[model samples]
Target: MRQSACINTLIRRRDNASEPKITDSISPKEASPTLSRLGFLVALGFLRLTSVLPLRLLHWIGGGLGWLFAVIPNRSAATTRRNIAACFPALSSAEQESLARQSLKGMVCTGLEMGKAWILPIEGTLAQVTEVEGLAALQAAAKAGEGVILLAPHLGNWEIFGYFVCEGIASNFMYQPPKNPQMDALLRGVRAKSGIQLAPTNRKGVAILLGALQKGELVGVLPDQVPTDEGGVYADFFGESAFTMTLTSRLAQRGTPRVFCGFAQRLPKGKGFKVIVHEADAGIYDKDLGASAAAINRSVERCVRLAPEQYQWEYKRFRRQPDDSEFY
Candidate 1:
């Protein structure tokens, strides 16, 4: 009853709020043709340069950049601190600060390493995964001809995880295109190189995901992203009310697919990454949308706890509060 009431209140607040609905479908900002082309060329050049450097060098550089972010007065740093403090209230202020710094470092490190994941040969990228913790579960589901819905949260290097899964299974990954058309095209080409189908985050995309699941193929969703008000519900995340997406729950209930949560943990000293997969919280399969949304958050929390410092704490995960108050 409490959960139901809370959700109802949240829904009412959202309905009455004046803010425009947030979505990923906004068109790219208008830019001059020449400038857009130049920008794309520069971005492509940077990717090519970074993709060739050793991972150790990239991490070393990223660490310095991340330290700057922690020390400087910036939105990312402030947001990271706020998120860490809220999610881990038991930690001392000093400890929270330290974790915030480390989290920034990890986040930057992952960004710098994206070249390796997206530009390098798929075989080479796969080799960087030194170990995989749970492959049998996925294999078992595939063997049984059951559809699998893998939830990869914003923990660790998710891009690497996507590549690894696409290579290992017949997979369809749901993604929202960037506002930059050139970047979107580049990323779409890079990701589809591994034989994985890319599903846009729209009605067509959802249909694509459903079709893939129905065919007993694997589908991946970034479960931590905030959906528009119409597509989400309020749920408790780390003891705070968070606007959680209902898509995962709807998919689970509608398709009856076997759900799993996983992430790629960046190993220390630039060694490599560890792909860890596990079953999602049992409540994710519950019929109640509120219970299922809460379960989605719980599953993400479980993954984040494995590598708290590596989680993407910089994102404003709790921006939509239950009382319609500002959180960031």
Candidate 2:
């Protein structure tokens, strides 16, 4: 099998460097579009306003907005309905609709919760986490100096989960940059507060992640997103054939790092979040690429099952089918 035919950049580093240079990736000169600048400012202002509100109030507003989303005829609601129907065939129509509504509500809450993550102090954010369920495994992995790959799915508030994990551990993760340069800068600034390395989703980013793993540091990936052609393979997710990223499997082949699945469970009425981590399926380490990808999907499914309603069902996960059929 061909290895990394899609990864495009080379990884480079100076001797004895702890962090890679990131400021050159996207500079202000490259993102001077007038419209994008306006949108970025508006977005930042909105986030600041939301950050001052209580968690309960934000969730209440999110619930109201979610109802509006479900009531209106839009692509997001339609996609959520189709995904729920395909994944949970056992549910009645009423049940599916209810689940779809709940999922939409959860997504809205997730957006508002980003205010707390981006604007609030690190201690303020950590204070909201009610508990961390699976710490012993991670601590053990760190002590062994074998590194760890944290497969964080799109369940609940992923930003909260990321912040919690990287707070204490020297971690690295790849993130797709936003279209607007200002927004991307703001995101990078907020996430940098924890002193973790953030790489843009590209060849350079993948290389950084690999380097971190080699150094016995934590690496995180959102294993649920649909990768581009040549970057993923079709895998059975919730009984449906979904395109799954092979990066997780490719990285696992490099070393004996422990792989764990994790997510932050949103508490009722925005009480806070609960972080849960568990061991990944053994099949993730299998030699077969397809099998490894499927195993990664199964790991994600297990995490989403912890709080199904919070999964980002609105995403077009099944958009690229194996037989070239359009799902969304």
Candidate 3:
């Protein structure tokens, strides 16, 4: 009887409160943008700090973050755990737990190293690339005087992949400019520091890419990013149909550009990053879009296999899907 009475009183209160109000407590347009700018400044400051800090110090901080995330019972983390679980089910519970721990550590370390990756010398970072194979293959592909397309997956220190191409291969790339204008200038400056031009992800950006191709240049891009709903097609990613950006395929089909698969595998400890390179697999340029996508994904798979620990396993890879599926 007491519970029923409480419920009735709550319902009455909610009904009365349904009427809206107009007050200063609601609008925050001016403050919102200002706060965002403040966040950008803080984020850049931290990036700068992390770049100079010793790798050991970053790992110590990263370990604490990993431990905290490992214990959390949450959505994004849990979903990533599930995806990883599917990839290596043969492991014991303890092994899976270790991977989860490492995933967080890898993520934190990457975050810590972003500033160095963006601004550090290419000669310094690419030293970790122990070996370079298939230079002749790359040269052969470029013989047609067409622009080369380099696709980096989420398998490694992707930041350095752009740097390697820009410095080693003389490539340029299109970038999604940061939403915050303050950071936009910073990113544009760093990404282009090696003399590679950064194209915007807009109509003009496509024109820039095509023009580069016509002039026999190289273009690098990360093909694993989620696309706008209107433009994406469902592609199989690690045994799941993920909404992958079709930009890679569309570009290859458009210009028949030679596509080389590359990724910067993050090394153990603070040893820096490595760039793994491979020729696109067969069927990547097939008339069948599905075949092409699968071939491209297979190429990415090879990059991932080069160093599984460095892969970005914690990313919201399968967040979007067709229909209303809660399996994620």
Please name the candidate that would achieve the greatest lDDT relative to the true structure.
Answer: 2
Better of 2 and 3 by TM-score: 2
Ten-residue region with minimum lDDT total, candidate 2:
1-10
- Go through the candidates in order and give the clash count of each: 0, 0, 1
Over 1-328, each residue of candidate 3 has an lDDT whose tens digit, in order, gives: 0011112232334323322342235545654455456556666676667667776677778778766767887653586587688777788888877887777666666666665665456565444354455545666666657678888776655776656645645566777754457666776777666777777777788778777876778877777667787656776766777776666776777766888987766666656555667888866777677777777777887777667666777666677877747656
Q: By lDDT, highest first, what's the ranking?
A: 2, 1, 3
Candidate 1: tens digits of C-alpha lDDT, residues 218-323: 8888888788979999998888888999988988986678999988898888789999998999899899999999999999998899999998898888998888
Encode model 2's per-residue lDDT on 221-267: one tens digit a residue.
88988888888989999999999999999999898889999888989
Model 2 deviation from the true structure expressed as Cα RMSD, one decimal place: 9.3
Winner on lDDT (2 vs 3): 2
- Return the clash pairs for model 3, or none: 157-264
Q: TM-scores across all candidates?
A: 0.89, 0.89, 0.81
